[model samples]
Target: MNFAKGLILCGAIVAASANAQLRFEISGVGSTQIPVAVASFADEAIAPAIVSNVIKADLERSGVFKVIDAGRVISETSAVDYNEWKARGARALVVGSVSKLADGRYDVRYKLLDAVNSGELSSMGQSTAARYTRLAAHKIADDIYEKLTGVRGAFATRIAYVNENRANRLYKLEVADADGEGTQVAVTSNEPIISPSWSPDGTKVAYVSFEQKKPIIYVQDLVTGGRRVVVNQKGNNSAPAWSPDGSKLAVALSRDNHTQIYVVNADGSGLRRVSNSAGIDTEPQFSSDGQYIYFTSDRSGGPQIYRMPATGGNATRVTFNGNYNTSPRVSSDGKTLAWVSLRNGDYGLYAMDLATGQELRLADNATEPSFSPNGKYIMYATEAGRRKTLAVVSVDGRVKQRLTTNAGTIREPNWGPFMK
Candidate 1:
């Protein structure tokens, strides 16, 4: 498939703002929910309500903050009445302002305050295009979250998924913000598109597109909408996994008649076999350190996750608790392993501590799990009632949120890397 020409011919670059906004359902709540009050910004001409709404929704959906209703509006530049907020049981308060700039842009300024201590936590200012108001709001939320929690926030990241319109036999590869906003279709085709994987730098995506009546891997530039077929051999070529440094890809190829693991350069040259197993070896993911490659194989009689040296060596079994385990994803810190496991006749998501070997079950009836860039949550695709929806769970399994769209079936979600 000539991916560049195919994307142009199919008209896949769809406007995200034209589609339906994703609706979020909070399934589980955390035990300690911090009460936060976000005051309305000062300016009404720049649509400050839209910015505040996005910030409130982001913190609320994370299950970490309870957005309290600020009874009266407060000016962003005015001093905050800490005693009033403390009486309302709010621990933290967020106040901001939006102003129309002289150069046809918007200036957003925000402050994070500690209500209990009556002190200022942090403050920031940003200037952005009027069209990117929501994105600017998300950046403010990320800053507030990091200041309060001491962990880097992932609110500024993005996610990629496949939206299949079975009725028209059309598939669209879409990208959206982490909160399911700013949806943009990158590519579209009549054939199936699956396994959307983001590049380490968040500029490109590698995915399997069956446009030529067979599985072929393509890497597309997200900025220019230009794409090239990286792996198009005679037989099945699928599951393109990016290495840590973004110089090479680990893919599964059946050109030799049996699916095996192979490492290929980013430009699709110097292909070298990594696994010599007879059983299917696929879904290869490189560790954060790039020292080992983790993959799923049935060489042990049943599908299980195995790890081999990045330079190719003996494979060692990593998952032993179940007969079936696949889609292994390592955390950014390289201390945890998350995968899909079948236990008690039910398939669920599991995470294991690499050092202690202790495992924890995250969710039941979940598939295609992808960890957030900060390793705080795991997003997966599952069936809600009869419709397929996307859900996210905290790593500790304490909080959960489900995201559903009014569009057709949604599947194969891959959380993008952190924004630069």
Candidate 2:
């Protein structure tokens, strides 16, 4: 935490070995719930799990669809029974099939049928390696979601987070699916790791590691396990935020005096301090347009969110309602801003509509809000009973889901971009 303000946020971080799989417990229904029936895919038993089941889970977790039982195995080639599906209380029916090829790839096909209208809404085919069965299902879900709701789905994206196991004295940075599966350890260290920011292209991650007994920023490639130090000045370095183009990074460096925001090239060169504030200025996040950089600063007697030119000039405060607001994050469309605000002694996730200046609180006791690729949901670390878990709330403050794990502490969650 760059100049900690007595707030700690934890997400759905998994541990090593047997504790890798993250579990989710979603609750609350949206105002409008379209009932969708997903049929069992033929030959999908060869997949990691049932491909149709994964599709059902993805749609259900979005809080936009209520899963209805299809009651039998149905493939994309099956004859349409729109009236039958409508009798089953399903507004839409999803049928898919999966076949394993001789070359060790799976061919998955799906069609979204409008039961009420008795017509086909959408159809798609995805071929993937045997290992990416879940990913294939996610893509199908994304297509179905977009066809029905007119908003791009974020189910196919990935999420990265920091896991600190104080009991075993282990620290790890891990990446997983947005729904918390397919775990991959990016980097591990006995020292702490925090503030993971995904590259705009979803190929790399920029984070702060304390392996050298001091904070330093490092940009690590997700595909290859190679990494290079982006910032390691005389003092502490933390809170690395990637630019929209992925060419440069805005981070907090304490080399000058108090922790201040600076821009640096991804290759660890062309470092220049951007914010010239006597008060600590940190947590620099670039806007979606790359025209401005939003950050947190205490220049106004207390920490408040601010925005300045991407190259840094006069900082204008963006947050006015709260006296303490930090961890500023803008949506992918650049129309919404999400940040952590301290209210009633609880740090919570708050979002503001940039066009109308309207604000709404998302989740209480939450911090570190990261907008999904489509900007439809905000993922953040929040308190769940006695343990810390991750929760995803829709930007409209309607749908909510709680993602939990069996053990370990979770922190610093970052949602990845759309790979397609």
Candidate 3:
């Protein structure tokens, strides 16, 4: 639980570039989408539609906003044209400008206005490197979203996932923006790589990599691209899940001849067993309060979700609707539990309210569901046609988005923590 140990490990990992950019398509949208219009920036000729387009796309993909045509919106910085926007059916309007600074940076300023009231809601400015124009745009979109929706925006966050290119016989660990843009490979090898759990601070990820000829758990620092083997025990070291405090990881290991949940320090010290079961117990995730660990086990003759103390003790089963359930992930508030459940031979993602015990099925044929930092959406890998792709569904099951890659299969997506 030492911060210094995580820092030391951070300095030892190396960073790498990603291989492909993930393309996203809105497979489904919310029934009631707020109509919003994004006007072209003042200096559009400088970057054309880069910033405005990215902002528009981000909002639209959330399944909560319907982006109006930019051609009909005025790009002026002066008074608001309430009648014009209202005629276009836009409830909210966003206007911004992008200017180049003397230091080679860009000044991106934006304003969120209530079109109906002809009033300014919020305005902010940011300066970023010329190369990070798109990221700067995402940040602005996030700001606008929060100002309008009263929910923290997740647009500025990143995602880590494993890509398997069977044609090239390569397995890659990749990171990209929440919109699936600017993808960069974090690690690549001929063997398989999976899990990919992000650290609490969003700077590091712990995943199971088979590059060493066995299931080995590695903690990779995203900033430095440096990596260290956190668990290289004899049998199998896999399924690494970071604790909420980022000081320890709950992992499933079979070094002792059976797969059981164990807790290990961030620096790979103080390893202790957390789950004791004769059958396989794996995929341990810590609750937001850091008091209980949720996991999947077959000790009761079938795979189901279970919970126990973080320090290891008596276990309690949580799921009762289905005989097969696994990959339990607790929400940010620890009020909801999301996991994969098998129904009629089809695997689907389901969320359960811990307090009410009411269950809601989110998506069918989905696996590896991880909640967004704000607990609004759950991202998981699902099948798209003949290939596997990444998808996201709102916690309410009203909004859905699918991210498809041009080549290879995508799996094991872990949404990162919110950006600082």
TM-score on alpha carbons, each prediction: 0.95, 0.95, 0.93
Candidate 3, residues 1-420, lDDT tens digits: the string is 000000112243233434457877776777788899898887844652378889998998888888996573345476777888899999988888888889978888888888899888888888888768888888888887888788888998999998788787777787888998778777777877888999999999898877767878988987877888898887888889999999999999888898899999999999998888899999899999999999999998989899999999999999989888998999998999999998999889999999999999999999999898988899998998878889999988988888877758998899999878
Checking candidate 1 for backbone clashes, the offending pairs are none
Best by lDDT: 2
Give the alpha-carbon lDDT of every model. Answer: 0.85, 0.86, 0.84
Residue runs of model 1 more than 4 Å from their true location after superposition: 1-12, 17-19
Candidate 2 lDDT, 174-238, residue by residue in tens? 88999998777788777788899999999888888787788888887877667888999988898
Q: For residue 334, give model 1's deviation from the true position in Å.
A: 1.5
What is the clash count for each candidate, in the order shown?
A: 0, 2, 11
Order the candidate numbers by TM-score, best to worst.
2, 1, 3
Kindly report which residue stretches of model 3 are placed more than 4 angstroms away from their true locations once superposed.
1-19, 70-76
